[model samples]
Target chain A: MNKGVAVTGIGVISAIGNNTGENYRSLISGKHGISSPEILETIHKNLPVGEIKISNESLAEDLKLPKNHSFTRAALLGAFAVKEAVTQSSLKIDNETGFISGTSVGGMDTTETYFKDFTQGKTENSRYVRAQHPGFTTEKIAEHFGITGFVSTISTACSSGANAIMLGARMIKAGKLKRVIVGGTDCLTKFTLNGFNSLMILSDEQCKPFDENRNGLNLGEGAAYLVLEAEEELKGKPVLGIISGYGNANDAFHQTASSENGEGAFLAMQKALKIAGISSESIDYINTHGTATRNNDSAETEALKRIFSKNLPDVSSTKSFTGHTLAAAGALEAVYSLLSLQNEQVFPNLNFSYPMKTSGFMPVTKLKEKPINYVLSNSFGFGGNCTSLIFSKNGG
Target chain B: MEVKIYINGIGSISAQSGDLFSGDSARIYQENIFQAISPNYREFIKPMALRRMSKATKMGITSAKIALKEAETEVPDAIITGTGEGCKKDTEKFLENLLDQNEKLLTPTSFIQSTHNTIGGQIALNLSCKNYNVTYTQNSVSLETALLDAQMQFDEDPEIYSILVGGVDEISEKITSFRKLDGQLKSKSIKNLDLLKEDSTGTITSEGAHFFALSKEKKQNTYAEFQTLFIKNTIQPENINEEIEAFLKQNNLDSEVIDVVILGNNGDNRYDHYYKNLQQNLLKNTMQLTYKHLVGDFDTASGYAIYLAANILKSGKIPSVLKLNDIDSKTPKNILIYNQYLGRDHSLILLSAV
Candidate 1:
């Protein structure tokens, strides 16, 4: 039990791809998924967004849901990804299996559709009302998958997915559950589109993580999940990677902005490294939390430099390909980190034309192959919530 | 050695006064949805910072501060919050304004406060306590999940001394009314205090915020030990007995050892049986208590149950107003809080005298 947390299976559906295969191909071949909003209906048609191409109706049909089912788009995406993880890992989901989901806007798509109707005495659409809460979507996903065990939803803004994974690993280590399905789901909605736009952090063009000319982030929609099994229960199962370390720390600096020195980010990485019982030099790759925003990139860069001062590993952000998926970003990149280990390849950071002056650290902009043993991924969210997860090559 | 978790301080802003059950009868509720009794707020928060906060943020911050102040601790190692429908008012406001203004010229205040983690983020900013921060939004079991997380923290990191954990849910005009249509709310307006007597299909609704400063180092004011907690996404109404037995067995206790059982029965005809099955069967002879009739039902209303247990354990006396069947216990020793929503998100919490 003291060895490590084993990630037996991983599943992800992002703007770059519908499944892990497509996402991996798109990643290595330098295919970018950022484009104009096709699935999301917004006034800013010219604004680039990393939106999944499939519609809710198509997603529901893919899941074989009923016509009048109450599953929201986010639930559909989560169920879709979780199905892949469960199937890939050959995992048995019984009464002891736990489902932990991370979502910021749970079912707001349904709420926005039925809110006005509810106010006008249209009571039939009331089922969508409570679904707006982040927990409802997790419940819907769990119900869809028949995961009738302990279920919890973490909604710590952007770091939610990483936190969900952290909690699931903790629960497994505590002998609370034998296996757990953990990840996050979020769909691009007009509410978030307008909200991030209101904050003036919505970039009109493709996001450039760690680039000097980075302006802001392009909101995206996606979901990813991983099957974490107790070390004893694995029983010779094919371990994709090991969740060796996880750390969480809040910036406590501002509501939506990071501090000048990225205190929370620094502490999060430090704690994660300490938990893994490994030194900074042991990390082969670092998947950074580069949102491409003016505040986030510079702050993250500064934090990265502080943690890996003497010898920096190959660092990169895949946000350029998938955009910032908000709550799903952490889990999405976790999949990428594991993919890098499984394939022994490095995915380049797209659209980074120039390096920032603060850190002066340019991300690997070209696909390359190398032997990697450990990878560290960070996800920092609004409300100053920052989480770092260390995924190491199995049997490392 | 087993690390122990204790409830050192508690702050609550619910339908009744925060300092409830102070040698007096509990306040009765007549409305369908009970609003929390709010404090001055200015006394705890600065004016400039207070102006921008929504009702949920205000309640969360003020109650967190009260708990910290009472515990005599300045900063906690971590801050965790459980919110069912977080900042619903702000969310509705942002949606309405976005629709009205055609998604243009919208401000970020309502949008910022609308997120589920705003309260946790704001509390961190106010206290400048930068440590592990997370929020759970899982309907009825939200607060229980927070407690479970804190328990796990103590077990995983013995160095972690204290964590600020709480649950907050605010009622809004459109959202509350919308829930009525889902058959979750009572069809007709009835006196909430007489909720159990009602032959209705749904229950009353309400708003509240409750925070607690939990620590491994038991202070002089420690009310009770947070012995154990668990959350089941669901269980059949008929199968609850076995689940309770198993949970109790896990904690090395049974119904007889539980001196007081706090039941979250909001009088929903279909689901009240979940509580009555215990009130009249396994835990029937044990002292039974109910609180939703007074505070009305909300997602995180179980937080009040924890408050009730802590206060009862500290005072060594049960408030007669919360009595259900009059089975008496001279001094309440061990308390169990069981809560669920519409037959889903079942949670069990065990609190014992420290």
Candidate 2:
């Protein structure tokens, strides 16, 4: 097998915790961040969500942003997470260092607040007008880090973060960049919350992944990032994990739902395994997309069975702790996968009491220690976007 | 060995009709913000689906179908799209309703289609091509990023023989109008043809979609060979020429070998200097051309520039409306496309006659 792309550092901020350490501690402690919304001003207060308690003003203050700074909530959280990753990697930003961020709503929060103002010819929030585009949010974070080369943004719904990481690995393999920061960031917004509620997919209780009685998902807000470097650029740097394989495929099935067979998820997993030059048996654990929505859980389970058959590895959905963070789900789970590799432990899938009826598959409901080498993380989203990433303990 | 990429087919829906570059007279708009000339989307989309699709989605799907049909490919190996402010109409509808209705009794139709990847995903669903799909939304460099990804796909997967790539953006009612408050559009009304003449603060803004069918294999109808692409998030105006020179030199070429330079000049006095620096200095001898004046300016307007470059290289004809200088090229062999938005997301795409 070929040596994989090296992951030097990782950072995350979610409902469970604010940083990597806090998130990890919460993950192993079975702490769920789901609750009624407090920070987001929405009428659906009874609906449980994974809302980060920090306010936007407080976030901007922590980042030392100026009064006139036009950072959206996503940008603010993205910068918060990116700062930690950059610090941990001790990376020196340069012209060859690229930044690829995945975000779905982007600055919709800002847009929602300022739309009426702009229509009334108010220019106070005019700076945020451009933030409506996902790339504008990316540019704000890139500027914060002084990364001038090859900055871009991906917006593939919930799969955005996974796609960003995949593109970074592919770019490194293609000799396009010496180093890159890849991940996703998304904050709760009335737009997304109401949208999911309109679909009747937002659960009023904590989501139970892979459970027969699971109702739906609890929306979450957070950001996570990984610092990926070319092998030659590492220069004795400590490697946290290696992104050995990645794949993306379209279901061409439906807009917001997966097929009964999870064909897209299957193709993505197969392709990722092929890229890793490994077989299904080599995977030690699976971090499923497991959004807890009836269709998603069953479809993902079917896809998993198609790949591993009776020899399924230890699988769990960390979303039980962080809620469904949309664009940030993939990168957030990726960080959990790296943590699993580093600790040789599988984080439990919380709130799951009964096994899914159709597949009758059981997930590790409690933290389990294992001799894990390869961790595969799945992220599926709207527009039939499905992606799978394999992180190896040792560079393969 | 590296595989060669060819631009075999192109489809576009913009403010000007398809005949704009085909020797037909161009339509001049006097408004600051204009809309694209839409096709009979019924010809491409079914009534049920069309009812749900926003203008951006309809334009994206139709243009993609036109491109795929022209390339004579039933299904592409991959579908990649780049959109700026994707499905804004839908996004606005959802947000407006959420605000007005206080998040009560909302529908998911508009919200489901607001995603930036909606276009790419719809194209995949239409063709039932469960192949690689993705979307980029990095503004002016958005389309260039897609092109770069397409180039890499050919190298990453041997089975990916053909990929459909495009850039799309559409005007929204309140969102597009917000540009006026932020100075993204001119404060005064002006004719589209006279956009370049006025020493203005902002250029006229419009929306369009341009799709290209890129394949690894050369065909009899190949328009041009995709040569090289370079993107930088930021660069000082003074350093732009050096960046361009270095980029061209890395590809074993320089200013002399370039026969035509398609510049993205949107008549913004503040940022047009980035283009003017090259027009006056390094590329003075080259036959310079521009297209934003005709199509208006948007994040993906460069798609029209690429369309122009590929057509000119294939037909060996230069449309007079795009000419920016008196210099002429007997047979344009190499064409360069340079674009940026508000002095950021700078990109360079080089195309050569095969």
DockQ of each: 0.85, 0.92
Instruction: List candidate 2 stretches off by more than 4 Å.
Output: none
lDDT of 2 by residue, B71-142 (tens): 998899989999988889999999999988888889899999999999999999989999999999998998
Cα lDDT tens digits, model 1, B40-146, are 99998999999989999999999999998888879999899999988899999999998878888999988888889999999999999888999999999998899
The Cα error of candidate 2 at residue A207, in Å, is 0.6
Model 2 TM-score on a 0 to 1 scale = 0.99
Instruction: Output the worst ten-in-a-row residue range by lDDT, candidate 2 chain A.
Output: A1-10
How much does each candidate deviate from the true structure in C-alpha RMSD? 1.2, 0.8
TM-score of each: 0.99, 0.99
Q: Which segments of model 1 are wrong by more than 4 Å?
A: none
> What is candidate 1's CA lDDT for residue B251?
79
lDDT by residue (A1-396, candidate 2, tens digit) is: 657899998999999999999999998899989989999999899889999999989999999999889899999999999999999999989999999999999998999999889989999889998989999999999999899999999999999999999999999999999999999999999999999999999898899999999999999999999999998998899999999999999999999999999999999999999999999999999999999999999999999999999999999999999999999999999999999999999999999888977889999999998899999999999999999999998554
Q: Please give the distance, in angstroms, between residue B128's alpha carbon in candidate 2 and its true position after superposition.
A: 0.5
